[model samples]
Target: MAEHPAYPVGLRLTGRRVVVLGGGQVAQRRLPALVAAGADVVLVSPEATPSVEAMADAGEITWARRPYQDGDLADAWYALIATSDPDANARASAEAERHRVWCVRSDDADAATAWTPATGHSEGVTVAVLTTSARGRDPRHTAAIRDAVVEGLRDGTLVAPHHRTRTPGVALVGGGPGDPDLITVRGRRLLAEADVVIADRLGPRDLLAELPPHVEVIDAAKIPYGRYMAQEAINNALIEHAKQGKSVVRLKGGDPFVFGRGMEEVQALAEAGIPCTVVPGISSSISVPGAAGIPVTHRGVAHEFTVVSGHVAPDDERSLVDWPSLARLTGTLVILMGVDKIGRIAETLIAHGRSPDTPVALVQEGTTAAQRRVDATLATVAETVRAEDVKPPAVIVVGAVVTVGPATAG
Candidate 1:
């Protein structure tokens, strides 16, 4: 006789007990989705990955610091058996079966009562896929299908329009490191729904170009507020558009609060009684350096990393940065908006006791197709930058961490 088909249903596991019988990679991967669904998860294993341990430390999940016992799943609404030891997995599955709780076994799906589906989430929707006809077959096919569905949803090809009940508001979104693909799924979805986009020069311009023709795209740099009133004008634009019942998106480059003046806009909106939401992006400070294969913080290399704005010259009266203190650090120094003043900045660091030979890397147009790197040291960076004609919007990395990454140079 043929076996009964496995039922496919979304479990409302919020505030409900769930038992995870492993702490390795498979369990690590499944725990996040369960935690995200508000499951009261208890992970059982003598050891766990650093990520799982971190989650336990953060109170996101409970960790039983020992191997699974027979009654581990007695109160669990669901159980996932993911231990590497087949014997342990079998014992956990057997206990779950006795308790009448459905079990998903990572080691052997045919020997399990449940199968975990390939899942993808976009906007407010979650998609889960499981192939019944090819049960216990290769998971790659299902994962591929999931990716295709997600791509369609992101690009507006798979639209499931929902009625908006809330009043129009502003979203301070960070477009990561000028790469269109680097923007978060939430950020991209919000961008597609925006009626008006007030964009900065450093944001992902390609994504802006893809906006629907009916949407209004304002150039923030060209805001007609003169030089001094530019910020005020942008704030007014966001408030005015939102008051008109239009969804306004103040899209900026990198994480909104990382030298992006996002809070200023949020404050302006709050005083105007406009609702505001912030969706942070991947900041270029760390992402740009990583793109160049430079880890900002490497074990035993850079214990600490500081990010500072180099827009103002070190000796300028308006500068608030303590160059002397920065020069004393043994960690990495990442400076943004410092290209124009890099020459002066480099000289200041060297003068403040930083080694004349400290490794420095200038990543221009980082994380993009036009990305280029120029290497130098404290004593020679200014000359090297000038010679390379490095422009603004480049990240300046200083310290041993630069040499520690794959793109290390003199």
Candidate 2:
């Protein structure tokens, strides 16, 4: 039992000497935070785990590559005594005490001068919880509390409206290939704080249901060669909401920059003097193929993978893709927004030098419950799409890599 309650304080260890006596699991877990805090850490250990060795190789910390010895903590501002040898730990702790340096012991917490708390970070706030009682300490309970507080803060469930300084701006967030769980933590946090969400139809539609009722959700769904909201109108909406002092989030499917025309929105926001943040999402170009058990690049089979926009036909004057050059390359080709132009694309690729027998796969509604894969060859892909009734928003993979994984039948 601790003699008194542990006083909580944030350590500014930047440029200060920190000594870690162990290079095992405990050190592996705690070293990263110490490095992130800009601490000049010296690790004293005969050997270390692979991860700790990686940090030393990267020059993040100095590894003594020997067991702890006397005077090891002579210049340390802080010490973590976690060596396998109990005697060594006791000697290090005694030395740290004699030198007036605060020390934490992994084995004996009560004997240590300092205790590491269960810590969590949300936004710019750090929550550290420590439970010290005459009975005993509960680390798991402390960790659970920390996780709850951080999660609440991140999701806006524990909102302190009076204390929050709401900054009005526009954020272009990638919703990540139709899976709500796949959305980045930063993106989800920003979404929870949004006052207005201009959502695309292809984005993770499930997340919209979780938004607070006060948030205005606008359907800016853009369909290929179909009825859809104009890009100019969407930009105007973002500018209007931001100028009105509202936090606006443009939630897009896959990556906002992967043929998503996200730059246009950023440029528009800049012209209107609105602060914009772009959070990248997992693009379906790679992720969709992966979700359907297809690797864009396989060893010996494919060395490179190219992502192209298939929204325009190869014969169209607006098309900018060099079909002849693409066919000459022996690599994987991932086409997005090309469901309608699959026939023209396949025909053009074949005419230029690509083999007609090359494997082709179309992954529809990838990473979602509605996901399905339709397999064909470059020669039969156009007809396969027609027979399968494959719709828009499917990723078309053309290469030998299409057959690299287990057979994915629709």
Candidate 3:
């Protein structure tokens, strides 16, 4: 294999004709980026996954509403083929080259020219970490390790504002989905010492009951589907307080960077030369599912899994999710933003040959006393959730491993 030219900047696709070949959640996620990048986004799929249809109706993208065919790459600058079909991705990968367009295989990009970079963004700065297996799956793990790295970097000697730190501060640590015990020991240490605390409204009100009586607790929680504080502003408050040399903790609901924008906040601190550190929280992506008695991995049941956010739709219609690979995979699938896209996600899974009757569990407010697990299969999970009105801050676990609850004494 040859080295492709270094990416121009962050993995943002501004002003590029990126063709997304799927209409599922992952495609929904990548599609928004293509549009945000000023790409003349054209989605090639027979059906509009709900997210895609919404984006299309909102005029965020152009829709072809068809499967990949010959000349689908006609005049395309870059092609991202993300179908549930490995055969489709492979075929698309081959066709993209013949048309002289840059192509990315959603599952095979690492071996090819297109790759998604690790992204961290803030008001003042943005950092993207891209790796090609030369360093292994650092990009995949970056999402996991990035928070800790930025936190230390912000507070370590690397940042600026050299002075006698004197004000009360807090570390906005993500408590991960719901297991207070899952918190990084360091996060627990800081929370134990907090003079004042700010936490997501979605989290347990009692999670902070351990704080001293004199400690002030503020609910910075954002109401779902309603008005809320801009997350950046919340981050700014944490940094400013720390600048006063005060111990501050900006507690997030789950893995901060996963979908909560901890990366953006850390980047802001780095640029401002403020002191900060990230404490890894047990991500809801895994914990929530686990709390539901679903082992994210089992010896014969599953060997690997993918965690993706349901926060936003992708600008590129093509997603990198290899349905064939995933279907053939022997690992459980845990979705963080699972509730929001349950219908579309299940649709795609079933469409791609995954058994519609495959067992799945959606755990709401996982790991806490308020947690509830609704069990069903891929075919019925979405409808069941709607009927039950199960909400977000939930984890959706899909696989045969979910056939019987992992903790249910099979």
Best by TM-score: 2
Choose the strongest candidate by lDDT: 2
- Cα lDDT tens digits for candidate 3, 1-410: 66544554454456667787888877877777677678888888888678889998988888888788877888888877788878777788888878887776667655445666655542234555556344355555766555554544333312333265444544658786666667765676567666667788654355687776876676665423335456666666667667766677778877777777788778787777776667777777777766777778877778788776544423226555555556555567777665877787778777767888888888887778778888889889878988888997677788877765544311
lDDT of 3 at 248: 75
Runs in model 3 with CA error above 4 Å?
A: 1-170, 222-229, 313-330, 404-410
Clashing residue pairs in candidate 2, if any? none
* Per-model lDDT: 0.90, 0.91, 0.70
Query: What C-alpha RMSD separates each model from the true structure?
Result: 3.7, 2.4, 18.5
- What does candidate 1's lDDT look like per residue over 271-306, in tens digits? 999999999999999999998889999999999999
Kindly provide the TM-score of model 2 when superposed on the true structure, using C-alpha atoms. 0.94
TM-score of 3: 0.53
Model 2: lDDT equals: 0.91
TM-scores of all predicted structures: 0.83, 0.94, 0.53
Which stretches in model 2 have alpha-carbon errors above 4 Å?
A: 1-3, 158-164, 222-229
Native-to-model Cα distance after best TM-score fit, residue 386 in candidate 2, in Å: 0.8
- lDDT (0-100) at residue 157 of candidate 3? 19
